[model samples]
Target: MVLEDPSNPLVLRNYAQYLESKRDFSGAEEFYFRATQADPNDGEILSRYAKLVWELHGDQTRASGYFERAAKAAPEDSNVLAAYANFLWEIDANEEEEHSSNAQVDENAVLVDLPAKDFKEEKRPSSPPLHLAMGLGIGRMDLVGINQDYIISCPDDRTTLEEYYKRVVDENPCNPLFLRNYAHFLHQSKGDLHGAEEYYSRAILADPSDGQALSLYADIVWQRHHDKDRAVVYFERAAQATPETVFIPFGFSNVLASYAKFLWEVEDEEDAIEEAKNRMPVGQGTATAANA
Candidate 1:
């Protein structure tokens, strides 16, 4: 029987989002599946559910399906277009590494992203291709403004990342994302803590929900200015706004543990213990969390 209520889909979507935020992947997937079943024809539902499956289980086929559905649903959404393209690139890299045992393109090739125009109906492959330089292009472009968590951060890639981020910022100064992430890159890679602080301040002004930026900025201020009280405020804010990614709780716990150690070393055993206790019973996930 067809359900007549549109709110049904909305409730399922929100519940799924909550579970995902809580890092309950299986539970989230279950609800997403329910959402998909309840609204099979909904492009958003298909796309979202497909995304959840891939995100939770690393199921490429399923992920691709949903991403495709999402793209189809929102043909004009650059975000969806870019995400799907990047996924294609990942698929290619996996296959290449699996077969060739090495991907040292050295001078033989420069990465090239095949724009969507290249994927005409007659030329579609039996499966997704093993290369889509376009995906890296998409990542380079789309991720430039995004504030990735500390865990996924690859500081060594700062130069190229910075170039892209600068380009993005130049194109859209109002987009505080690139500026904020650039600040993180500076702090982490170049030790330009002051520069990072300025950028972070700007980002916070631009968007209150930029918790990663705010939290990291707080860490910098606390460590740089030796303001533990202020740092704790940021940490608490981050923990509050933080999503249930694979790394957030772990990141929070690690920082807390480090703060505790620092306090203990300084003979502030009370605060040290307090900090340690704060992160204890770490939410869930990761090897460290399991040990805790």
Candidate 2:
């Protein structure tokens, strides 16, 4: 039914996802290829296809090509950039492993003397290879911008990751995911407490019922600003927004834990311990409720 409109990229992409979920690699690849052909400029779709290719083929070289294409397609899209960064990180890790394995093999091999080959002057190309000199026709996005998190973590590049976060935030001001992640990046990487707080405020304002955002905001305000009163307000809000039963450990319970810690450690309230016990008891009821 979805493929009825073969021209619709969204439908094609969704079909591709369905195929991928079903573990139909070839089917998924065909659908993804069609989707990309239908909308070559869609960064999200490209990224999805890139990830599928990587998972299906387990070849970082081919996957990197797709990732580079996706990043170029959406230079300002933070998700695509992050995906590209992850791809690069994996490739680097794989290369390091290969080098380590080679070194170990070399170390175990017994030394043997061999006659040195005579040096010969071979015919060389008159000019550099055309492909080597040629640039990808697509606009060149700054490597630092696409791999901001990697750069910040490694700290090898001279450029700061602040600009990339600022650009992504500016481009996607209303996106809660982007705003919260940018806030986190600023807080962790740059130690820009004030800037992080501002972005966090925007994220919370956009979605009051977001327990994670509320908890994160509370943590930041309490830790950095040292305003326990303001922090507790957000924490209480987070607890209220939390569901009674959550399957995910990092769900509502994590937020509650944060709140409990603040109460016990900072406020020194005995109710904190009581609240934890009351909220989550060690019994089949918790498991049953989670299953339900």
Candidate 3:
């Protein structure tokens, strides 16, 4: 019989996921703790637990610790690193490659967002990979900052994360999911746009329809490499193929807007705006006709 509020870690984990899916990050984190204590070897719990820390507070260090656990648990899953690299880029911009320090990225740059991904539910397996891989290392990530001084004083702690992510890429080369994630991390953290471009390209070859690789590969080429022509092509492809995903729109839009801005500065304003509009309508067919 299911307990109304069972103390089982698995049950708590399910509840935590329910809270997270509802956008209640705080609730998820709290329950995730109860779950870890109940079952420290649960990989799914660790992944969500890590992501919860990242999303609610942008605590990359703690989040990274959790990611380590999650990664160890499900060595073949890309979703674990999917949020990590992106959130790492999102938080403390100065620490990421795009921004030299915590000041800003492209002083004139603004956030380019794509349409949100459609949410579809899927059934969970009784024993998922995430649940089995929670072997150990839960406490390390849970600590609120073993090095407080490093956090407040340092404007950029990119090195530590970069090393960690690099190791992830190197150690998990055999797993396509891990390889995809590692490629993604490099794209965001390595400070080598060309290298990032290569990794993302390889990831695409590994998984052609991978939304993460498609958009990130485009970002590296267009934004960092100044190749708007190729960037537009990839952005348009990513937009068309990955319309149903919430995150694709934002990444796709970033490329689109960047290309358009470049065009405006180069006296091709009309075509620039038209191209941006072309990919923005990808989800219209799937959405209700009224909204479309």
Candidate 4:
């Protein structure tokens, strides 16, 4: 069918899904790419391609580009918005884990020190890496590792990462993924709570159903702004927006847990607390209460 009607994006996408189920990832990738080229506005195809890239190849940066495109192509698609939000959460979790691991390095561990004469200074490259060029060609300035490479290549330059993030947000202003990431970078790395809050608000404005952004924004409101009422509103919205599915069980569970905790501890709203508890999975309510 695909060969007979080579321009049929649905057929191409179906074939890609079939190939993916058969574990023919390379062939599936080809078909998926073809499907996207055939119908660039198909958010479903773009989301599927993004998931395949992330799951099969573990290429977060490339998957992010596809997901961003998917969200842009279909701003009103709930499934696509949920998937993109989940991807951003996964990226945040991985980055936090990496930071935690780095922080755990033994302070007392002895390091072998080489003589000064044993080391030679290496010349820095005149331009960004090849991956950066490819990313630029594809209008993906937010490829994670390429931007990190540019920053690492010039350790003395602290603004490289911020500049790239600014450019990405500028180019994709309404993209929740970019806005959320920029907000996170500002809050965590730059210590700019005001900027983070602004971007987080923009992200939520772009996609009010983005549970991750809603949850994180709630945290900022609670911790930084000390606006308990507003924070509760955001947390409740996050809980309502987050769907309980195998793909995003953690996100849903976390939102529910946080909401419950806030209701119980912060607002001391017993009725609301019980409501939130009932929404949680069995045993999660007990654990959340204990943690609270």
Winner by lDDT: 4
lDDT of 1 by residue, 31-149 (tens): 87788776666666676677767666889877877876665565434344445545555565567567676655554333355444553332422221111111222222323222322
Better of 2 and 4 by TM-score: 4
For candidate 3, lDDT tens digit of each residue in 114-173? 222311111221332231122111112222232211111133443343454455457655
lDDT of each: 0.58, 0.66, 0.55, 0.73
Candidate 2 vs. truth: CA RMSD?
19.0
Q: Rank the candidates by TM-score, best first.
A: 4, 2, 1, 3
Per-prediction TM-score? 0.35, 0.38, 0.33, 0.40
The regions of model 4 sitting more than 4 angstroms off are 107-292
Candidate 3 yields a Cα-based lDDT of: 0.55
Q: Cα deviation in Å at residue 257, candidate 4? A: 14
Model 4 quality (TM-score): 0.40
Give a tens-digit lDDT track for model 2, residues 1-292.
6747989999999998898889898999998989999999898888888887887788766776777677567744546656665555555567668988887745333334322322111111122122111211112223313333222323354434455456556876887766776776667767888988998899998778878779889999988877878988998788677663442424554665566566555634446756765777578557876899
lDDT of 1: 0.58
